[model samples]
Target chain A: MKTFFTTGKGICIVGIGIGITAALLQKLGNPPNMGVCVACFVRDITGALGFHRAGVVQYIRPEIIGFVLGAFASALISKEYRPRTGSAPIVRFLLGFFAMIGALVFLGCPWRALLRLAGGDGNALLGLAGLVLGIGIGLYFIKSGFNLGRSQKTYFSVGLVMPVIAVGLLLLLITRPELKTGALFLSTKGPGALHAPLLISLAAGLLIGFFAQKTRFCTMGAVRDAMLIRDFHLMKGVIGLLAGAFLTNLIVQQFNPGFTGQPAAHSVHFWNFAGMLLAGLAFALAGGCPGRQLFMSGEGDGDAAVFVCGMVAGAAFAHNFAIAASPKGIGPLTPLFVGIGLVTCVVIGFTMRKKI
Target chain B: MMPDRIDARGLSCPQPVVMTRNKMDTSKSCSFEVLVDSGAARDNICRMATGMGWDVQVTEDADECILVLSKK
Candidate 1:
């Protein structure tokens, strides 16, 4: 097969797709500044699975399923599908968990952070700052040689693991599996209950996944590249996405600007920045943002897959225990979780480095 | 002037820009053709090109785009 799309190209294209898709979603009736948020969607999925019982945020998002399956398809076609594991799997899992915590605290992911800004959410300014700070910290680790140990290529089945899990979840979603009398694990209402047509969401995801697989777009990486290397290649794609979305939103009359009353966002500039800072640091340390992580997981990276699972679990824990922040303020347990997440990230940075 | 066109078409967000920058420093007056499938990449690349003082012309070819730039 011929491979024309490199990793960087894939990210740019995928970012564009996401930008377009988000605008479409808003036009088609989803919330503003929230066309596609992997973290928020996953949080809703967690609620759908009855993990969080947050009545307002539960739903089985088909777009997520499409993200994984689409990535899997692309990986398979590109012959880049290499399943591997065993580099501090548990620690990676914990990092994934805390990463979500940080994102929830800020109310957005790296992609969403950028999207928020494009849509005129001034709160994103602080979030973007925080994201940069967080990634800067992670860069320090990289500079100091904080390695997660190289992943050894494992059995092909290892990579298939996430796809299988995704398929099972799909089945459950379709069948409404009655594992318990009144607890079948599905979102009936709230943000989780909201959905675009499954086929539409799935098709969009698959197309994005395929393109993302081809291009390898990452929001965190875009900022990281610009900051660390004075490079703007990936940042260019991000600009494209923002520009596309901005135009689309303006055309569609969805370009609502402000720090307050933004859909699925809060006005806490410090936390917004801090939350994304933590998330950015985590993505930098882990080598990708949540969206990129999902794509990697689909491509048979067990570590990435573990990270996705960790995000889902983290979302569950956040809502179940009141750790995820809302539009009003930090959730009941966010302070503790954020503290732990920050400490853990710091510890990982300090300890996991080679003394040059 | 080696007219090198970095087909950042299928690549992700930062990689194209990263690759472009990497190539830019070495090449003088070369045409860097950046093909992006999304408007986002195209716009960002265009802005960056303008900011860098490159003569940029964008042509759309069926959703995929080509940004031709002559370096200063």
Candidate 2:
């Protein structure tokens, strides 16, 4: 069958669908400016699993489960599933770790940056600029032939691991498995407490997963392709996403245009940029956005699964160390950690370049 | 004779480029015109057209551009 979703118009529709759904999810109480954030959702999942003791940001987000499962289902139906691994797993993990840290500092990922902007958070501009700058730097490394090495095909079970984990998480979410005190913490308030209904959230995630899998959607990829090859295909989808979300926010009366008082947002402009700069650099090095990583994990990429695990661990570290920023403002150690992250990424970029 | 024209204004990035590419691919015409809203899209389409062995002329407007491509 001819796949319409892979075409330019189809991708635009997919972008619109994602944007509208995110806006609707926000209206349905999934937190303002945070209708769907892969990094934040993963952090919440990490907390729910008791990986971190952050009391205010613990929940088993079904959207994440749906992302993996939905992508798995799409891959299965399309016969596109190819389990693979062994591509500098440790480095990928470190990249994911720093990516999560950067995201936490900014309180958003690339996807959330656009969502925040569409919802009228002017502060997102700085973060967006940082993302572009970071990606531009990553492009230089790419031009210099920086590679993480090649991945080899692995057993089919390797591909099923992430999906199985997702299923296990969904089961835990549904059963509310009683654990001893301090075993599994549930947030009673804050961003972790904010959620759309489980089924609705799962459905939205599944739809996005299916479409994103078909379209190979990635915000980082969009920017990379534009800068490296002057290709605008992916950028069009991004523009579509922004336009769709903006229009939906306007219709829903959720558009609050300002830099201050945006939910789950901090107005410290410099850290916002620096945070995303770190995240964008990490994502470029890792070769996909957080959402793309999850999608890849679903399709049986064990390396991507490793990266996902690194993100979970990074989330724990962020909350435990008080490095994550809050709505009030930047954390005390944000600058220090962001500086470290930038140095680390630059070192990797330089050391990993293949001598041609 | 008037050349075929595609007014892809207000369309996003690749859409404008894709539309221009599609028209060029399907038509046997030697010359055509495409109107786009963004500088990026205008430049991208021109690059693609040039790579495809087409002569290109771009006329800029306030926030839009018209690219005329002739087969080389």
- Best prediction by DockQ: 1
Among all windows of 10 consecutive residues in model 2 chain A, the one with the lowest summed lDDT is A1-10
Candidate 1 local lDDT, A1-118, one digit each (tens): 1133443465465566678887787666455676778898888777767777778777677677888899899878756676767766777787889889899898878777777777
User: TM-scores of the first chain across all predictions?
Assistant: 0.93, 0.98
Q: Could you give me the TM-score of model 1 versus the true structure?
A: 0.80
Off by over 4 Å in 1: A1-4, A7-13, A178-181, B1-72
Cα lDDT tens digits, model 2, A1-356, are 22676567877888888889889999997988888899999999999989888888899998899889988888788666768788779988888999999999999999889999999999999999989988888878866767676567678898999999999998888888776676556789988889999999999999898778777778987897788667666777788888888999999999999998998999999989999999999888887889989988887778889999989988998888889999998878878888888898899889886521
Listed per prediction, chain B TM-scores read: 0.79, 0.89
